[model samples]
Target: MIAEHAVPTSVELLRLDADSPRTAEVRRKVVGLRLAPGQQRFSGEAAHTLPRADTDPNRVPFAVLYRQTPVGFGIIDQRGILDEITAAPAEAVLLRAFYLDPEWQGRGIGRTACLALDPLVRSVRPEANEVVLTVNEANPAAVRAYRSGGFTATGERYLGGDAGPQLVMRRPVPYEGGAGDG
Candidate 1:
C-alpha cells in the first residue's frame, strides 16, 4: 500500500493539446523540471517530444498533475521505444519522459505517479499488457523508485544511455475487463 501523508495526493494524466489555453501553463511547468544529463537525454522536452495524435495514432502525451497542479509529464506509447528495446513483449507500452518537479521528488508523489502509469496506460491502450522503461543504472534513486512502484529490472541493460548504462525495467499490467465486461 502507498504511504499516507498529511497532504492528499490527487494525480491525473491529461492529454497534451497543442491549442488548449492551458497548454502554455502545462509546457512551462513541465519544462521547468530541468532534467539532469542522463534524465535530460532520456526525456528531452515534453512539448517537443510529444507527437501529434494524428502523426502517431498509438502515442499519448500526458501532463502529470498533482492535486490539480502541474508537477510533471510523460508519454505512453504503443510503439517506438519498445520496438527498439526488443526485450519487452509486443504487448508492452513504452513510458517515456516521466519527470516530476525537484521539490516534489521525495514526497511519494513520484512513486504514486509511477504506479498509476500501468492503469493509466491500460485504460487508454487496452492492447498493452505491460509498461516498460529504461532507467540509468547510475541513477540508483530512480531504479529504487521504479522498483517501489512495481517495476522489475529485466537484467537486460541498454548500453546506449547518455550518462551511463541503463537497466531495462518492466511492470506487467493486470488484465482489467473492457467496456463489455458486464
Candidate 2:
C-alpha cells in the first residue's frame, strides 16, 4: 500500500479484467479516484468510464499502478472505436479516459504511465503503429504532460468534445526491434 504522502518512483500499466485477483481492490480504488478541480472538464472519471469500457469490446481498460497500488486509469481504443471522433488511420490506437488520482498527479507517475502505453498497446493490438488522443485546448497542463511523454500536436481540432474544442495529438509506437527495425 502507498502512503498518503509518499511519492511513487515508478508506474506500471495492468490490464483490468474480472478474472484478476486484484480486480476488486483495483475497482474500489478506481471508484474512489478523484480529479483536481476543473479537471473534469478535461477528462472523465474512472468510475464513470469503467462501465462503458467493460461492455465495449474495442476499448481495453487499464489500471495505472504505483508500487503495485492502483492510482490511475486509462483506456486504449482499437481502430473502429473512435473512427468518427478521431479520424485516425487504421494503424493508430486511441488513448482515452486517462487520468491520475489528484493525489498522484505531479509526481511523474502520469508521464511514466504514458510512456508505457506503447508496449501495452503493441502487445494487445500488434498492428497499431501510433497512439492518438485529444487534449482539451484549455487544459495546458495535460497538453504539456502528453507532450513530455512524446505526443505532438497534429494541428487538428476536435470540436465534438463536451468541453469546447480539443487538440489532436499523436506519437509513433516504437518498433519492437528498436529504431530502424523496419
Candidate 3:
C-alpha cells in the first residue's frame, strides 16, 4: 500500500527548463549533496563540475524540482536510457542520482523528489516497467526510505564501499494514461 499521507508536503516538483533560473540553482544543489564527486565521468570535470545546464543538448534531460523558485533543488536523471545501461541492457529507468541541499533533506524531500519524477518518467516512456536505483548500505536511512517507497531488493551489489555494501532496488512503475498489462 502507498499509505498516502493526510497532507501534501512542502516540496513542489517542477520541470526545469533552460530559460528558468532554476537550471543553475539545481546545479548548486547537486554539488551541495555531494552526489557526484568533484570529477566524474557522467557529471563532468572541475571546470564543468556544476550540473549540465538544460541547454547542453548532449547531456541527458534532467528533471529538477524546487521547494520554491530557488530555495532548494532535487534532480533525477533517467539512467536506463543512457550509455551505462546500454552496455548491459535493461528496460528500466535508473533514478540515477538524487540529492537535496542538507537543510532540505530528511524533510521527505528525497521522497518528494522521487514522487515528482514519477510523472515525468511516465510522460517520456509509457512502457517503463520499473525504476532501479543503487543505495549504499552505509546510508541506513536512505535504504529504509526507499523500501517504504515500494522498492524491493534485487540481491545485487555494486561499487563496494568501506562503510558497507551496496544493493540495487527496483520499483514497479505504473503506466500513465494507458490500459495494458506487462
**Order of candidate numbers by TM-score, starting with the best:** 2, 1, 3
lDDT tens digits, residues 87-108, model 1? Answer: 5456788887777766566667
Error of 1 at 26 (Å): 3.0
TM for every model, in the order presented, reads 0.78, 0.88, 0.62
lDDT of each: 0.71, 0.82, 0.50
Q: Which candidate wins on TM-score?
A: 2
Q: Which residues of candidate 1, in runs, are more than 4 Å off?
A: 1-8, 17-28, 36-42, 51-56, 84-89, 177-182
User: Where does the lowest 10-residue lDDT sum fall in candidate 1?
Assistant: 1-10
Error of 2 at 107 (Å): 1.1
Candidate 1 CA-lDDT value: 0.71
Candidate 1: TM-score?
Answer: 0.78
lDDT of 3 by residue, 1-182 (tens): 12344222555555454556665665454444433332132223212323453433322444334435333333334443333322232446666444444444455556665655557666545456667777776666668767766677878776533345567777766666554323
Task: Please identify which of the two predictions, 1 or 3, would achieve the higher lDDT against the true structure.
Answer: 1
Question: Which clashing pairs does model 2 show?
Answer: none
Off by over 4 Å in 2: 1-9, 80-88, 180-182
The candidate, 1 or 2, that scores higher on lDDT is 2
Q: List the residue pairs that clash in candidate 1.
A: none
